[model samples]
Target: MEKILTGTVVLDLTRFFSGPQATLFLAGLGAEVIKIDDPATGDPTTFSPPFAGPEGVSFHRKTQADMGIAYLKRARGKKSVGLNLKAPEGRAAFMKLVRSADVVIDNFSAGVADRLGIGYETLREANPGIVHCSLTGYGSTGPERNLKAYDLMVQAAVGMMSVTGQPDAPPAKAGSPLSDAIAGTFAATGILAALLHRNRTGEGQSVDVSMADCLFALMFDEPFDCYRSLGLPLRQGNRIMRFSPFNAYRTRDGWVVAGAATQDDWNALLRAMGREDLAENPQINSLSWRLANNATVDSLMSSWTEPLESAEVLRRLNEVKVPCSPVREIGEVMEWAQLKDRDMMMPLWNPLAQATVEAKGPGFPIKFSASKAAYDTPAPLPGQHSREVLMNLGGFSAHDVDAMARRGIISAP
Candidate 1:
């Protein structure tokens, strides 16, 4: 299938999660993403934990020769080019590459890009059609723009932690780094939108993504509505006040979550639980009545589910077409047959290991009949394509490349 972004070129200057994740999405859609890293220390995460090497090897515990799992998961389908962006020669070479690229992404602090002289204004001057995206902790033009924000901090600042976990327990962060993931996803969306706009008008623009802002946007709407209506947004763990029996319940073997939003759905769930008496009971028959007596509703569902195995409970719920499923572990999700059939799990050859490794890709979530996303390239080694990119894309000669490498302007593989 033809890839959606077949001809696009991207210059990736992002480290860590957000920016790299965004470019991974672009790469999956067939954009050629060239990751520019510092020669001294190529992507800090490359040295971090959860490594994948030749089958049974653990890279982090053994050696730093292999890339980390975090980098491998997000750096697929990219070429690595190491250049000292702080150097004048490197800056000139980067400007030359900018002229030939469609997008440039960074996730530095607010003013760092501008200080490094690779800000949107400067890049746009070199290529007016360039879509430059800045992913930061906070937005560029705000009081908190200069503040440092990691995933947990953003979650806490944006009230995501407050509404998570049981009310009895202290506020807890989500298991995943939702803030960075969400911001990166938004960065990809914003870049795509800018690309579309550029296609029409032959003009490119800056896309500023704030992690805190993204988290705020996600947690704001409902809270803002509640605050306006009732002075505060009450935090209800697992289930919202608007619904009953809409939470995870313990089963004999594991846990399952089930919900019945409508009267019909509730009746179906009751029938599935073999509780026709409850189905016909007037006090809890309708959704509103059940919500008013939510404690009783939840207790009844718990009693029905507590004794059954998770799989059996899921089977019973599915029999009545009630929306329910077992709360799967990460391992179970990784091996899910349905997801595998849809190509969500993609394998790439780890160059260091000389072995194939599996990682999840975006799965071309929005499928097209004649077009799809691709994940053919594994993440590159540091400076893996530095010479090739300089010679081919930057139009530098062999002698010039050698001279630049010798001068600490660029790194060679």
Candidate 2:
């Protein structure tokens, strides 16, 4: 079957995590995602890595020949085409490529694209129906647009750290770089929606994605609203502001998590603990009463679970129809048959290592009944497809490519 984005061409001018992540999805969906790197430096991440070495770290300083582990993870199924967009000739070459492309995406800081002379207006002039998307630290129009955007900074700016971790402990970002990843997903979604609109109207539009905005959109949706309305500390650990007995409990081996958002669930949880008789104890039965006595409920639940193994606690909770799970180690979860069956951990070919390795990377989170997504390819070496892309899609001749290469505007490699 034809994939969702088969035959589409995307000029990807994104670097680092956020932009590459967005292109990664488009590439997986079978789009011809051409990653435009600088002929001089390539993608910065290409050399900024431990290169998948011992202990997942390398003591040796990375040389220009090395590819970053991060680059390999996110650049799957994309072609690397290098061009010196800083040069006037390079800008012209990019415009030629853009004229044949359906979409153009960049993660340049605010004003960078304009200064490079390839902003939305320039792209639109070259291809009127082009879908131009920009993923920045903040939106282009915002006051903070020019602020240097790091994952840690974005997390702090969006108040993600404010509500995370233990209440008394220091603020923390999620283990993963969430804002960039989320903004990528959002950018892909917006591109798909915009494509639908263009199909009907024969007009393309610009997609402006702000990392802070994207995280805020997601984080503020329910948690922030709930915290404000309930007047609860944002950083309280594990438990929800309104719910009682909705937290992780210690078990003999590790931990187990169980939650009750409804009366039936609450009753079933009590049954899980073999305390069905207490379900109707008015002093502790109803949610309102339990909310006021969270410590008591937690203490009682802990007493029940502390004696059991995580497996046993899970078994009892499952048997009673309560929503519960063991606090699984990520490595252990990676080996599960369920994840293996679903292909959540992908076999990615690492260029730097020249081997196929497995990591717990996302593998097409969405499933389609008729459509399919393929993710067998690895990321490219810097400008690896420079000759092919320019010669074919950009309508350049061998002489033209050689001249550009001689001028140091495009990578000959």
Best by the lDDT measure: 2
TM-score of 1: 0.94
lDDT at position 223, candidate 2? 64
Model 2 misplaced stretches (Cα beyond 4 Å): 53-66, 223-229, 358-360
lDDT of 1 by residue, 1-413 (tens): 87999989999999999899899888888998999999887888776776666543464445434557787778788899999999989999999999999999999999999999999999989999999999998889877889998999899887788778775678899999999999999999999999999999999999999999888887776654564374333456678666677988999999999998777788888889888887657778877777667678789888988998998999989999999878899999988898888887776556677766544444545556788776778778879999998888899999999999898888896
Per-residue alpha-carbon lDDT of model 2 for 1-413, expressed as tens digits? 78889989999999888888888989888899999988888888776644643224353544333456677778888999889988889989999999999999999988889899999998999989999999998889866779888788899998889888987889899999999899999999888888888999999999999999999998787567576667667886888766778999999989999988888888888887889899769888888888878889999999999999999999988998888888878878877888778777786565656665433356877678898886658877778899999999999999999999998999977
Q: In TM-score terms, which candidate is top? A: 2
Q: Where does candidate 1 clash, by residue pair?
A: none
Cα shift from native, residue 346, model 2 (Å): 1.3
**Worst 10 contiguous positions by lDDT, candidate 2:** 53-62
- Kindly report which residue stretches of model 1 are placed more than 4 angstroms away from their true locations once superposed: 55-59, 63-65, 224-233, 357-364
Please give the lDDT score at residue 296 for candidate 2.
Answer: 94
By TM-score, how accurate is candidate 2?
A: 0.95
Number of clashes found in candidate 1: 0
Q: Which residue pairs in candidate 2 have backbone atoms (N, alpha carbon, C) closer than 3 angstroms, thus clashing?
A: none
